[model samples]
Target: MAFSSGDSGGSMADINVTPLIDVLLVLLIIFIVTAPAMTMRVPIDLPQKSVNPPPPSNDPPPPIRLRVDANGQVFVNNNPVATRQVEANLLNLLPPAMQDGQAVEPADQPTLELDIDRDASYETLTTVLAAAKNIGMEKVAFLDNM
Candidate 1:
């Protein structure tokens, strides 16, 4: 608090801004100290463009499209498959190593595109998803069949 220097020796009504300035300066110092740390980047190993990279030898395999209709009928590549045989049918489409219970390499993993009817039962959807998961088919995608 500051006292008035006028004839009236009462306390000044004006705000005491010295403390506010001090606090602002302290905050400014804290931000200055932390600014560099905040912007410290994580070093990433980005792939560099090669001057003469070799052309890819072969095209990737076409994605397997699986369709599930409103009646819960499952189809693999447009061929109707029984609900009990869905897993086997999918396994047949995969590479032999996958069918033989071997860990699949990422490059050899086949993508499964699921085209599901909106009116399809949740039970049917879950069954399809469970089969894919159990078979270690990681690249399953939902197709907008509308």
Candidate 2:
């Protein structure tokens, strides 16, 4: 903060770092204030159930199979279905007790077997997953190498 008198024959060439430090501190404060906002919670349709399914039944309904290929096409038991129809398809596959828009208990929840192709887009997978959750399917497993 020292200001040399102008009477000196040569001008001072030293860099003033006080102002630079002040500017940097201000920027640091601003970023810290905005950091939490960046991580604010968003309401997403996602399931919270664990992968462990309930005990086996005498003859449990067959698991629903979903296949997603590179082109983002979704197939249920080899039948092609649009991404938007997945929720409805899941509802149709469930039994009467689990199909009335009420949250299904884990024992009554159906298992979804996902066979994702090697080249499928991440978006396609997420979309299919969201549809399942929106319909409240809790048991899901990802098939490997297909």
Candidate 3:
């Protein structure tokens, strides 16, 4: 067999991947050495579970729906009631319903649900809330349209 360089030639030009493999091995070793130091150590205290049952419902009576229109008119239980008479009306109605004679239990107290029109002012809503508060009603909820 005879080998020629120029006119009578055979191709021997090919890229060897041995150098690439060596480089990748070196990078992998470097990452393994530095990986532990680069990570942030965190101490976590996870919560434990308990088999205790929840306390019984101390929920108030059925909610009284109060609607306030754009004109600042207040409605108690769907019936229109004057703004000035709101506190008075609530005071009169709530006590009797909750009280059996003199003693009124905490569980018997009714919740208040306020449904105000989009055009209604915040002042009117607050006033209605104030009335409920004055009448000793604690649980109050605002009605929103989905």
Highest lDDT against the true fold, candidate: 1
lDDT winner between 1 and 2, please give it. 1
Name the 10 consecutive residues with the lowest summed lDDT in model 1: 53-62
Q: Choose 1 or 3, whichever is better by TM-score.
A: 1
- Separately for all candidates shown, the number of backbone clashes (residues 3 or more apart, or on different chains) is 0, 0, 0
Candidate 3 — worst ten consecutive residues by lDDT sum?
98-107
TM-score of each: 0.58, 0.62, 0.52
Candidates in order have lDDT scores of 0.84, 0.83, 0.73
Rank ordering of all candidates by lDDT, starting from the highest: 1, 2, 3
Which of 2 and 3 is the better model by TM-score? 2
The lDDT, on a scale of 0 to 1, for candidate 2 is 0.83
On residues 1-146, what C-alpha lDDT tens digit does candidate 2 reach at each position? 44676788565667989999999999999999999999988576456666885576666777888899889999998999998888888789887777888875666566899999889999888888888877778778889972
The C-alpha local distance difference test score for the whole of candidate 1 amounts to 0.84
Candidate 1 residue lDDT tens string, 95-123: 87888989965456788999999999999
Identify the runs in model 2 with alpha carbons over 4 angstroms from their true place: 1-54
Alpha carbon deviation, residue 20, candidate 3 (Å) = 62
